[model samples]
Target chain A: MKHQFGDRRRLLQLSIAAIGFASASLALFIFMVTGTALIVVWVGVPVVVETVVKVRWLAELHRRRVGELLGEPIESPYLRRTEGNLLDQVRGLLRDPATWRDTVWLIANGTLGLALACVAVCEAVLDLLFWWLPPGLAMRAYARLSRALLAPSEKSRLALRVEQLTESRAETVDTQAAELRRIERDLHDGAQARLVALGMNLALAEDELARNPGAAKALLSEAREASSNALAELRDLVRGIHPPVLADRGLVGAVQALSLVGPVPVEVHSDLIGRLPAPVESAAYFAVAEGLANAIKHSGAHHMSITLSLENDLLSMVVRDDGTGGADPSRGTGLRGIARRLSAFDGALEVSSPPGGPTELAMVLPCASSLPKTLPSYGTA
Target chain B: MRVVLAEDLALLRDGLIRLLEANDCEVVEAVDNGPSLLRALTTHRPDIAVVDVRLPPTFTDEGLRAAIEARAQVKGLPVLVLSQYVEQLYARELLADRSGGVGYLLKDRVFNVAQFIDAVRQVAAGGTAMDPEVVAQLLTRRSGDKPLASLTPREREVLEAMAEGRSNAAIATRMFVTEKAVSKHTNSIFSKLDLPPSEDDNRRVLAVLAYLNG
Candidate 1:
């Protein structure tokens, strides 16, 4: 009985989505005609191009909606022309089949779309007016028609998948290179510098030891200090590479331990039932740590809170800070690293820090494995 | 005078024993692993224990764990934990009970023979001797604090020195300032940081640390 009602509700949603597209397409058609007519003045250049982009965006939404109604995935088929001159872009849009399909969709939506919506609404009213009237058959027919027009072919779906894989692969390579540079810079500035000083001090101490034992003691102490500091730097470097604490305490405890080191107070609330895959746990840990570090360093924030929970296959974490807001991905800082860090896991992050207030960052990772991993006999201490 | 030492590395362990003996402190027992350290602690009931952060039988925080466990068994048992890299989290864990007789210092501090001996003796006498790095970590927690902003740069340096459990004379000598001048700055810091007038330096340091941790 619930499934039947759910189907009915889905049918209603499908009809409403179609109606929304139909109205939007009518306005879009009006704008396109004006945009083309005013092309001689070049005032419509932006307008026409923007409409073209808007249509593609609208088709993506439509495809996603139709796919949701079908309870499956629907991939966008447009080979996105993210680079080109303006003339080439316009030509490219005109040359694309998806653009012409959008035009056909607009025209069809303008005519049959309006008729179908009116009939669907009137049928509901008539059903209320009468006793035994069901609109399932008509709604199902409309869904089928929309699907036939919008769904991508098998070959195009494969193409879309390949494009996505290639882009992510390229990004992974770039991220790796950037990370190596960062590690190299850290070593040069930290342990390497300290070791050089330590080596020099040891050499000088050797010379002074035989003649001036008193001064030699001071020099030896300084050298010892340098070596220990170098060791400290290497320890920190190792921790950053992979925190042994994470292995001992798991994600929740590791995060708690980590936040204790933040300059500002951090409250972490995590509700996860079982362990995530080791790689996923590590990725999520660094992502949250980076968010906290940024808040402490740049945000000028007083207090921060991190909350993690699992919803279905996704583990979601939100880190919020009270600070001088304005966290932009385009600007410098480790904000961009969060994306690169999670991209490997098919995870995504969103930052919302408008100027002059609180910054809230949300990260979500799809986890297919929620079974708690068995503890290794020896996980550090 | 008596101490139990736990360190994994043979060379460092030997060096530390020589350093302690030279400083006139007796080594009651020395162990390289966590279990032996625990057994030694119980058997000797030494005046204090100096444990490394990472030890054998896991090599990750085993020494710290053993020290905490030993302290639990022996109330206010002075334990000065040495780590290659000191973390504020571990420092807080050591100080969490709000009981004295705890010192968490970076192993680098051992190079300064006089200061390291002073810290060991201080911890043995039931006074805390936090590493300068740990103190720096605490000071950073209150960065941009409105009250902290009122302090002069010199006064901030004085506070850093004080948080490392240094006496006014030691701070004065180190900063190249007179004792009277150091005292005046401490008075100002106490008022500006709004620390209640405390006579002893250890209580003052703890008060300042607690305030910073806030």
Candidate 2:
């Protein structure tokens, strides 16, 4: 009997605190009104942004208070944002569905939400004075009201997913364009120039054949050397585009071949039974390659290992090295480039490197089962 | 030596045929696609099969596959694979049987005609003739192996030459050392790698390659 009285006293105190929070809702209502009214003018953008920011803070406070009354924490539904310029920040705020929801929440809480708090206080007093009403019923109703207005709807979740896809697609296209330009530059300066020189050397050798046999021999040798150099450059360029070994062998075999070239020995483990999609394979291969290169260049340690596995349609790759373990993706373009490459395939890269020890880089890509190739059906060309 | 050649490009095929004939090797048959090459290999049973890595009908490692398949049927069948590029994976696959009659070289090696013919002859005699590039890659791969780490830098060089199927005299010529020094390095390498002494150069190469591929 005494415990029941103590619970009602605590409920009465919480109801009073809930009524106190209602006063901030009126301030939010005024800000929304002022911000919306001034949005037509040029100076209204910053005001509206500030208004949204305050609304988020107030909504967070309401979520906390309501969550406490309901006995569970409410998750904030706002999308994460990086630092941007004023205009971009404003645009981001306007683009977010959560901001609009917050505005609606502010309006609802100012009117009906305030009334619920008042009714809860009246009920708490009436029940406390003479056990005539159930305790905390109005407060429970207020918590449900806040939750319905504040939680992320399904449409908002879909919008967030679309925004992420748009970002990654734009980045992938930009990276591809840059890669094409680099390839063009490499051909222009490396193989194409070498071939032109080889042709000129051959023509000179022909001219000097009758007049100067020794000069002709020297020119012929130069032509041969030039042709060899051109071939070497083209081989490198082709490897950069898509390694021939990768075409012949799958990802594991290709990575095995790649491991043979670097100074450090890499032990590879795999549970992949068959091939993945070509683009997924390529992306994963390059990401692992980048990891190996980074380990060799930066990690002063001696050993490295690569492991690949496929489980439940998710392909996972992990590259680990025992070296000085301070790797920052933002500081180096290699890791950033890997992240960008993976994002195109809806893959993700994760780095875990504590100071003074081993470093591990993990990546995951969702892919389907291997498709069987029609090798025997291919006839002679 | 009798040879069966498979190359997709007509111009290179003619040049290779002419080069082989001039060097006193008989071209028993020459074909373009993977299936025809397989048929030619089975029919002629040539002393050596000079195959390109990329052939027609698939254009992706068709010739290498056919060569490997033929070797599987006719055990220890000599095959010299040429490719625009070299891959350690293909080298390992060709050597996986631990058979001595295998040669893998870059197409650029053909520009050095004398060395190229020497490799072809060596392979036909049931000896391995790996490209120096592939040898370098194998050496890099085994850098962390404990016994290889015990070798001196000169010994490592000698080991690389040996893995490329070089005779002690050839290694001496290449390294500007006497045959005696090359032999000393080879003996030390064999002892360090724990291989039994052998007189046959092909067996010696097979042992060295088997150790590296291990």
Candidate 3:
């Protein structure tokens, strides 16, 4: 009970302090605006500065109070300009929105805070002094009045809690639905669409074959091209969902698969003889693929080297190239997407590309003990 | 001519067999994977084998391995490996053996029916056929060499086309020139690179491959 009383007292004190500071600042502001030059220089300036400082202190106190109430640790933003020169300090003071708004709040809250403080003090004193009064005369009357004032507020609080829970659940359901829609769209637009077009082309070619041999030949050629294209597109779509090679042959084989598709010569070096976690392998594979794609398309590189190693319980990768080097991560979405993907696994990506030289991309992921039990054997066999 | 086809896709495998049969070549065996391809090669001993780059269990480099293994087994049996995409690594791996009668081409090349059939026939006859895209990649990779720097633009084109295993006639058609002019350019390219002048030999292809792989 004593602890509860002490908390209430602290809250009241902070409220009063905030109000007093705001009131003083507001009065000073009005005085300065009205061309009261003498008062502005003598009292208004100092009062404004003091009010600003006190309001900031109060805001920090309030943040701590709220954190304590919620049982969480939260740090507050505070002014820490101790080393600046006088002019810089003045400029900072003038530039900060907190300085002006807080000063206004302080000046305005002074009168309101004084009245609330007096009323609270009087109520506390009366309640304590009248402890011995008959329950029906004092305590019962006070409880009735307080209940009347807080009943509607208690009902609204319950309603707000229900609304918050419903909102959160709705958000979760919406996110899942969006993901499902995305997957469906990928299938429809990618592989299925191409297969349908291929079938149509084949039908047209078959019809034309009995009518005219020359036209049939052309149509047959188009059909063949469509079938080949559809095959390639379907292969890519299937690979996107889950590469069978990655599952069957593991990360090394997956990287080798990518290396087999690159236009430039890629030398793959790996000290990782074992398999990694599925997510880790996927992240690493995509990172290497995107890096290689960028290097080939934009770097104008002739030769590239990819190295994957396990160092100190971390899977690390480095892709380096000898090209016309100026690679900027900010200019491309590929690197940014890679960074986001790596962040999901608590991995780190670093790039070093100086102008007119070699570009290197390095990534490290923590997957020491989480590797798969058995490593698949893969070779040119 | 006799041929063995190995492709993982059932539709493509069947279509290719029909096409080969229609072209009057005997397809002795049709298998779906690299291991089966090797098995069929040993059992049938077909005159030529057409393989795909990606095959069963793991579709990475199984076909390339099968081709290399078949070459090792048969000594000089012709092999043609088709791929949807071209990679310099695979080309280097195939050319690394340096034996005669090998072909690496993009699968789309089959759309040009006459040309693709000719390529198959050429490889079966102890000759080489490579895709122009693969040859272009090889040339770009080798552009930094001092020896390659001496060739003129037209000579370079001729060299690249030759690396694709195009005969003088095909080279003439592609370059929009007469066969005599292509022959003259080929001769100049050989002499400029200090290669032996073997007119009867298909030395242009050999010269381009040497420059690209070297």
Candidate 4:
């Protein structure tokens, strides 16, 4: 009885969907024809592009509806619109085979599709009147037809992969540039200025040495103090760039060093025996650092724990804190920055923070085992 | 005192040679790379070897690896490792063998020539000289440990000074207290940390370091 009721509901839904599809198909057919006719005057380029976009929208609606009926989601096959002037966008749209398939689908749905939709509507009506007729067979067949046209092809899947790589590459370049700019600003405002002051102090001290010993000694001390400050600033800047510990000791050791200085105690656990690629280690280190920083600043927690492990070719790291939760990646640039940094290396970040308690941030990255690895013996007793 | 100095840059190497010579310590051999440093250490058997952390040909802890290997070859070889930065991990590794003659210091510490020479002399006399930064990290890392937690604030300061391989007199001078007061603080810290009482200062330092490394 439940199955029958479900089928009846599905049949009614299909009937309404078919009516909508029929009207939309007719409207799209008229637009395509008018736009094609005006193309000789060149005023219809945008019109044709706009019509193709509308057709894709119409096709997407049917795809979702039919996919729901079939219990399988249909993948979108359209190429992402490339960024450029109007001509490039138009050319890209026209170059895609899926656009042509969508055009053909629009035409076929206008005629044969109209007929199938009408059949569906009639079958739904007949089922209500005569309870012996099968409720949703016609709707199932229409869904299959739409699926055949709208489902993603192998070529489109490759195109989707290329789209993803291109986006991540661009983001990585931007992140590097921003990092370089930050280093430059730090040097300019910090060590560089201090060094200049140190030099000036030394020069004045040298001149005063012949005149008075006490003033010269004071100036020399001032110069020494400036130089020390400069060194400290530069050390910090270098650590920010690439921690020397990360180079000397691998990721786990570096994180152990990081945990030592934080306000709250952080317990670190790891089973990683060999070093990962430097970039992967660096990314994981910064991600954990950001996670710890966030927890310390906002979580109001007393203790945190970091766990790292390697299995197969994947590296997994988790930073868990026992604190009041509610960490939103969209709301915090720290989390988003970690995401962007990881995405560059085909890595992912997952945050699970419920409202009341322990927040866990897990990161996973594929570290190919074929790369040469240094077995860092952190035999620190 | 005789020394084998290994630093990559020519200017700093020359500066270090002059500094040591001015302090009445002879630099027996000065080399720029890891292999040469190891060779110098083995052949000269100098009183001490001052090595950089980064050196050619690999340039990534090559000097440190060479120093470790040299120590393995020549037991109790005093090595003073210097770098722009310091790590508690590296410090612990250097001290893992528990050989008394070892030191790890930041390159910046050379600016204070008297204290730097003092550290070198201390390490040469079969003692330890850890950078204050590394010692501070040791103190903080073990803050949660039970023994360290029970330390009074004054005792904790004395412990940090001791972990940096300072003698009681040096620590007392720095803390602006008498040597007697510093020794009292050290005794209190040893009792609190449950360390076996020893007359030798280096043993006290090594015990404090081992406890902190936990």
Candidate 5:
């Protein structure tokens, strides 16, 4: 009873949301029935579609509020709603398991959500002030019930995880293919062209040698320069393919070198003790670099901080910048690239950036690191 | 011209030495890695340092870093960075020093002996020589602001030529136009890019490049 009122603010907020959920579910049920009955008329289609979407929205809100009250997160196991024309989106929604799950939640949340809200208020008022009866049993029960009913079933949750893995794998392949094409294009426009020009220069030099020594020498030197340019282009292409520094110095060193070279000042702190797997290190390096690059280019930020830690067998990074915020992962390829790279490592990235100021990007990767073979070292650079 | 060379490959280093020697430029020292290159640069304090972008002992940007560090230690240290490719990012770093004695040229540019020599000489004499490829990259980067987009194609080409540290006469010769016409296009480029007008080619190149870089 005493514990129920300890977090009174959350109880009250959730009570209101529960009430909202109950009312919204009732309205949804009515709309659903009316639309079904009037299905013969084409007007019912849009109403039914809108009802489904709203039902999901309400359930999502209820889930969040309940989860907050419980002091843990309850994930919505909904697949992303497809974006398309109305009819297509309607058809897509109809076929979605989450849509049906949400509809069921809507019906249940209507009655149970209302009862839970009323019980919470009654129990709190009766017990907190008067100590007439123990409070919060109903509210606690409702919170647990919401987690049970609103969240995805184990099977569906696994299915969604598999689907996400498949999609990310496909993206990884596509990103690789796109990268290869870019390299190919770069080579075509850069070294290949220079080599061809060099060949022509050499051919001219050989022919002109008999007639004009000075001009022939000039052409010969030109040929040499062209060959040098071709070599330089190839070197750059190889560097782009794999930064040699990453191979030499490991992630920490590579990232430090990157920040040192960046236009903006970047501070790095690390509790990461040892080298990570090569692939993970590469992905993390690139992700950090991209974050830093975006801040330098668009954020107009004066200062940036990167923190790396390996605790509880989890490698986590927080990239924070004092800049014009509003970074949307969906808006640009940079953040999306970071997310995709992280997905491969079973890592996660969270971005919180409001319009007025500082942007914070937090990335968590489930990884384990071994102690360095040579020595134990630690620092904040 | 006295120069120090930093390249990872022995074959290429020897070839570069031969090429420079043929052009009346002395290669005071030729080292294959970063530390030696830096040591040579400081020891010789030559008229110029021709450095590769990649070198031994952590080859990624080794020579570029050496160049930057060298310039930091010795102001206006003339460095003609030779790379297989050129990036605007690298160009920006090279030109970060306002007192210009910088050049970044693609290795293929070395094939055009006269132009390559001209770039080396230009850098040696405290001028800027940026790669045309890098210049193109800078020019083609789409800016939301209409300033760059506002230029006519002709003016953009002139601007590219100018960014490569070309004089009005050289731009005219390349475009097969009168120097006066090139001058007019440059004026348009300068105004369109919102830069103060100038006859000094290196200063104009730096201004236009710094803007394009942004």
Candidate 6:
């Protein structure tokens, strides 16, 4: 029932657009033939403006419909160029593709709209003129003709919209699936494979323990080293997915935990006293973790500090390291991931790592409305 | 010696139990999570407890918390925490109580079975066995401290070795210096840090640990 109603509404919209286009074109034709510059200046400009506005409105409608149907977030930024002078504004409008496309669509719509109007009028006239015959038969024939004329065009337009939406969704899903596969491949090839090899080494070492004590000892030592390496790799892989500490203790605890492990001295100050929404906490935790990792790996200086606070309902974190600086977002995937994570939360990441000292990484995330009121107590336990 | 073992992984737990048992220590209780670990300490009253920093059901600092709680409850009951990562935070938390019987080492240390066992023994005997990594982190953090800067490079090494609870002889051996020279460095470190010259090794260790742990 809802679907039928939506179809009917679309049909009404198409009919209105057809009528508006026909009227605008006829007015333009009349002004052109009479060579009335004043009429052209007044009527032509309004008609052109109205047509452009209508097309833009339709485009926005289409975009919103696609978002709703596909259940995905798609942002289209409409560039609104404003200039100080009228001449500059006019130049900007002329350069805009939206304006040109709208003009072209309007000209095409004008021709089709006139043809549609003529058919509608002719059908009505025939029905009235044939009133002397059986009224029901004549009316039914006219209705059939109108339906045949409109069905194909309406169906084509509907199909075009659906096709565009489907193509966009397919692209999104494909990208997401590809990312998942990449992560799975990384784990399987990197850590899981290493662990399997280590296990086999352990088995071989066990068999040779008594028969070849000297060789067995060496094999045992190799197996031990392999196992340790594999364990470290597995830990890294797990951390990439979700650090267990972050999930268990929330963002503050997670950052504190990271500070404890780093080679440099770290001081942590947090005002996020309570548990935040899981996704927000996760992003914040990883952002800080990545920052700390970068500081430790690249920075030569020793002291590091992390601060988390809620400012004006937004969760903000700043990680600073007093080290030889020059950290760049473009140089590493870690900082890029941090940017992406913050963006997902409608947040922003700002980095300031000038040469010769103190690198600072800052991130802000919109706080989830469902955060707990009080901070959870944290200690060794 | 009776010991309680707290580790999440079944295979590692079993292996550690077997190893400790072979070393003539009785494994009185084996618990996989933090709460159970604390409960086991109360019930078993083991002479020592070996814990993993990560434990079941959230796996972040649960074992560390349990170890701290257990120490508070049972006076002089030694605790050793093994962690996959070297975290200066955990080290500081362990040393916060100003106790002499705590140990924190990276889990990788387990591969060197003899040294790991020796550390456990040291902790059980009411002496600290801190990881070199933890000491390094502490020193790095304390680089800004005036007292730390006052020490010469050799004196810094002596202080670090002292913070690890090494004897003057061990420090000399490690640094390849004469024991007399190690003694001189220790005296210089003590004087620079304004610590009273104490004859007792344990007292000297406690004083140094207090300064480093700060």
Native-contact fraction for each model?
Answer: 0.55, 0.68, 0.13, 0.42, 0.16, 0.34
Candidate 5 local Cα displacement, residue A129, angstroms = 8.0
Q: Which ranges in model 2 have alpha carbons more than 4 Å from their true place?
A: A1-21, A35-47, A60-96, A115-144, A369-381, B139-142
State the DockQ of every prediction. Answer: 0.32, 0.58, 0.11, 0.30, 0.09, 0.27
Give the per-residue lDDT of model 6 (tens digit) for A185-264: 98788767877877787788788887888887887788788777776776666677777667566888778877765567
Model 3 lDDT per residue over B38-105, tens place: 88987888889999988875667688788889888888778898987655556666766666577889
Local accuracy of candidate 5 as per-residue lDDT tens digits, B27-131: 989999899988888888999999999776765678899999999998888999998656555777788877778889877787677888988887897777888
lDDT of 4 by residue, B132-211 (tens): 88866665443565667888888878877776778889998999999999888877877776777675665675665755
Candidates 1 and 5 compared by TM-score, better number: 1
What is the DockQ ranking, best to worst?
2, 1, 4, 6, 3, 5
Pairs in clash, predicted candidate 1: none
- After superposing the true interface residues, what Cα RMSD does each candidate give? 3.1, 3.4, 7.1, 7.7, 9.4, 6.5
Best candidate (score: lDDT) = 4
Candidate 1 chain B weakest ten by summed lDDT: B205-214
Pairs of colliding residues, candidate 6: A260-B87, A260-B88, A260-B89, A261-B87, A273-A375, A274-A375, A380-B65, A381-B65
Best by DockQ: 2
- Model 3 misplaced stretches (Cα beyond 4 Å): A1-218, A228-281, A292-305, A321-332, A352-360, A371-381, B57-59, B136-142, B192-194, B197-205, B211-214
Clashes of 2: 0
lDDT of 3 by residue, A233-299 (tens): 7555666655655754567877876775566878899888876766678778888888888899888
List the candidate numbers ranked by TM-score, top first: 2, 4, 1, 6, 3, 5
- Candidate 1 vs candidate 2: which has greater DockQ? 2
TM-scores of the models, in the order given: 0.71, 0.87, 0.60, 0.84, 0.55, 0.62
Per-residue lDDT of candidate 2, residues A224-282 (tens digit): 88888989899989999988877767688899888877777788999887667677778
Per-residue alpha-carbon lDDT of model 1 for A294-378, expressed as tens digits? Answer: 8887889888999989888798989999999999977845888898777767889898999996999899987755534544434
